[model samples]
Target: MRDKAKGDGTVKPKVYIAEPVPTFVENYLSEHCDYEKWEQNEKVPRDVLLEKIQDKDGLLNFGSAINEELLEAAPNLKVVSNISVGYDNFDLQAMAKHNVIGTNTPYVLDDTVADLVFALMLSAGRRVCELDSYVKNGEWNAEIGKEHFGLDVHHSTIGIIGMGRIGEAVAKRAKFGFDMDVLYYNRRRKEEAEQKFDATYCDLQTLLKQSDFIVLLTPLTDETYHLIGEKEFSFMKETAIFINASRGKTVDEEALIDALTEKKIFAAGIDTFTQEPIQKDNPLLSLQNVVTLPHIGSATLKTRQQMAMTAAENLVAALQGKTPPNIVRG
Candidate 1:
């Protein structure tokens, strides 16, 4: 509350948005604060994030890395708002140590991401991309035998790596939409698991071995970083479809490429990458079994609008000497 007025009593506080929010959020933002948005999809460089936010009380960031090194440049920063559900890009320990509040947009993206998870599962299960190419290349009439065949989802087994809000939504959809067996692997076993969708809890190794489709839904943490390595891939069934909609660093890309190239796994689908914009010479680019996306898990028009507005509200509230709606820390 130290720097509230922007030269006039009615003028709003200054809020720096590392990402450009949709038009829907502008009105809400104008109500409480004036915002500076980055015009492009590029991440704000660390020095720029610090320099621009040095005097600002709050910031609305999307995938901007706000580590201790970066935060040192912002002594006036009161709150950091992330438009994403995953805050791995931010350094929570540093923020907490510095007494800066951090918030994330979570519930809004849950369903959207769950939907994406199922979409990847279905695309892999049916060989959608491979066959689409075949048809486009006028090879549909050819003798595409069992080698090009796919699996049936109904009565099949599904394994989810994380059983959080998104995971639960995906489980419910799989249980009802395909009548599939749902097995979830998480740090802790949830109770609604059995009550809601009859989801069973199993160790990572067993889940990988049993699932016809393995979906990754966990956030990236030091402990979970590269949690899926070569050894983990070795435990999977050759026919198991691996779908990663979670943070890309959670998986070891080298092992994943080896698995796909060696036919260790049936197919793979990825909506995120260890590096964003996926480098021009990334190794996974050439794989026919992999389906890559530009991180569109929460890209629905309505969901994105809601997420932007929520993130704006969080910054406004926190900087106005109030608690944000979705505070990330305890």
Candidate 2:
């Protein structure tokens, strides 16, 4: 580690970037402060983070948990800026207790993630992966039978669990492109969404039972952990398609497994998982009706550049004794 004091005779704010981001973001950090960065391909091990953070005033983090244990190890830490929209990994209360601020990149990746959610919905409903496998497995010698038929997406009803920015984007696509009816359930009604897309607002149970497609887009919070469980699955129509582009813990994995195995719903397209890089033996992988993806909702090159830039700006602002633009409150 270099000396904490700079040539200007002032202590340079030491910043530790947990993961490698865009090159432009790295350049910005290097110009502004004394910064240490982890390699792009792998996360910094927890032990290294604990040791390095002791002298850091700011942290640029991606996907690592920020809690009391981490905060206790970093007495000088003043801010944590996450390069993603979701901040469920942050323990806000712990940060507040330590007088540290939290910030996240939002609005930049909404359209990119919305596009992925719509793609997942279409693929799951149409059995795109299954049939591709069927052809590659040499089962295409004869015309496919009625048993291989998939469901229609256009003119169907889609119930969105959260009416946030990305949810509104998905609703717009469903309404404009697919001519589908949009139903949404949120704690508070989205009047503009209803006015813009002719979307209907309803209770959770009503949305679950009536829609032909169900998409979960709620953020992860105490109130929303395992929001969809066994009873929630029972509410869906037997032919409905389920899509989750939100946090994995929002849905109970075991219940989802049972729902798919028993044919409670037609199929599910999942982007997030309770455990990332989902376990090898996870039952969802063995199910024919489930389409699973690594959590790549915000993985587009352009959007990621924007997110990294935003996070860098946030970290710089906080370390300079200014309030971060996208600060997250406890």
Candidate 3:
């Protein structure tokens, strides 16, 4: 029986990429494990997933939701490798209950995400997108109005929520590159933030009240869901700016639209939304003060490839019963 158990430990571990992983990522995974994909484009069918994942030794998943019900089906599953940095789509407590180790690729796209954050900040504050539209529609010389002038980002106060890796990176951009005072609110104090960015760690209320630009970088969790609603917006300066490169559900969409309509805030740059692909009739999209993106915070080719390779490497390591470099949830 001891010999059989040893053999079981050494047996070839099957690795599954729930979605079609990139070729380089596949090659990287192959360097360490026996791997195959489940789907080419869209998600593999639910029945197909339920049937195929039953005996998987390890799984690398994407946007697909993995809950307790799915975990129950995979008796041999030992690990989950998430392609994205955010793992809210995966049931962490349920995975822990099943003795399943889950890993996410964080920090790999830190700079890339920070770059996009600043890009949105500049575009929104300077009205870059709207100005470009004006030129495209032959209205370039018609912008001599009181409200057409853009806000000054330099010498402004930048408020950040969620002082995580991405949040810290955004601070560097605002404080260093744009010459802004960095104010942040986290669940706890970030001492290193003061040393690095000269950030003023304050209560959520203080940050909202003081900042000229509010940047959201928090992750999606129960505590953060709808974290920025009307009460928070009421405190923002009328000339203030807001940008969300974080999860969509973090902000109250209705409140944000109302803020834009009433001119409570000067402008906004939003990437993620309450619903992705933002329905055609979404009120926020109709607002002139808001600039929206298709949730491409880490969409640069170089960064995405690196994230995929990192996820693949972590999955391979977890499949072989080794400690993955970026394992989350303790």
28-73: candidate 1 lDDT, tens digit per residue:
8867786676777677777777778877778898887878876787
Q: What is the lDDT of residue 22 in candidate 2?
A: 81
Q: Cα deviation in Å at residue 196, candidate 1?
A: 0.8
Name the Cα RMSD for model 2: 1.3
Question: What's the residue-level lDDT of 27 in candidate 2?
Answer: 88
Q: How high is the CA lDDT of each candidate model? A: 0.87, 0.93, 0.85
Question: Residue 288 lDDT in model 3?
Answer: 76
lDDT of 2 by residue, 1-330 (tens): 775665778877899999888888888987778888888577778889888798899999998889998999999999999999999989998899999999999999999999999889889999999999999999899988988898999999999999999999999999999999999999899899999999999999999999999999999999999999999999999998999999999999999999999999999999999988899999999988988998999998899899999999999999889999999988
Task: Kindly report which residue stretches of model 1 are placed more than 4 angstroms away from their true locations once superposed.
Answer: 1-11, 45-47
**Which model is ahead, 2 or 3, in terms of TM-score?**
2
Residues 131-212 of candidate 3 have per-residue lDDT tens digits of 8888799886754686667888888899999899999998998888989999999999999988999999999999999999
Any runs in candidate 2 off by more than 4 Å, and if so which? Answer: 4-9
Clashing pairs in 2: none
